[model samples]
Target: MPVTLEEAHELIARAHRRAGELGSHVTVAIVDEGGHLQALGRMDGAPPLSAQLATGKAASVALIRRDGAALRDMQQAWPALFGQLDQVAGRPILAGAGSLLIRRADTVLGAIAVSGGQPQHDDECAEAGLRGLE
Candidate 1:
């Protein structure tokens, strides 16, 4: 099933809480299966650039149906092709540690990403966001 807006908000809230636990401010973004922004949350102390980065990372995961780390590997292995993907998708695609594909029972619903913390911290917060679905 597709994720509901309420669920998206819950995910953002969980991510924000995780960021607080980590002693970091972050921006969390939720994108639909179509890689369209569904919701976004920027914590009080998050960097301004984190907003765009979180959205791009989430969209990359949603459209690619893969985690951000794997996408980073792809970018490393095929820089040219990966560069072309942004143009092809008409959206900024960034590979990093903060993004995850949202899935349930083998069905992909969307994706979530967190930014402004350390890469590992961001990844952990993204995971927390996914746990919101549970």
Candidate 2:
């Protein structure tokens, strides 16, 4: 099943909770398997660009079917190819620490992303968000 609206909101809430514990502000974005946005949330202290960044991260993960960490590896290994990736996503495909593929069993349901904190903090928040699905 695709990620439901309720699930998206829950994911955002869970991410926010993790961010709070980390003493960080963040923006969370959830996207469907087709790279369509489902829901987004940005904390007051988060960077203004965080909304767009979070969305791009999530959408890119969905489109590429890879977690953000792995994508970052690919980007580092092939900067020339990754440079042309924006045109493919119709937006910047940020391969940052906080984006991850949302899966069910072996099925890819969508993706989730968090931004506005240190890479490790953002990654932790994303992991917390995924727990909402469980």
Question: Against the true structure, what is each candidate's TM-score?
Answer: 0.96, 0.95
TM-score of model 1 (CA atoms):
0.96
Q: Global lDDT of each model?
A: 0.92, 0.92
Off by over 4 Å in 2: none
For residues 27-108, could you state the per-residue lDDT of candidate 1 as single tens digits? 9999999889999999999999999999999999999888999999999999999999999999878998889999988999
For candidate 2, report its TM-score.
Answer: 0.95
lDDT minimum window of 10 residues, candidate 1: 125-134
Query: Alpha-carbon error at 14 in model 1, in Å?
Result: 1.0
lDDT of 2 by residue, 8-50 (tens): 9999999999999999999999999988999999987999989
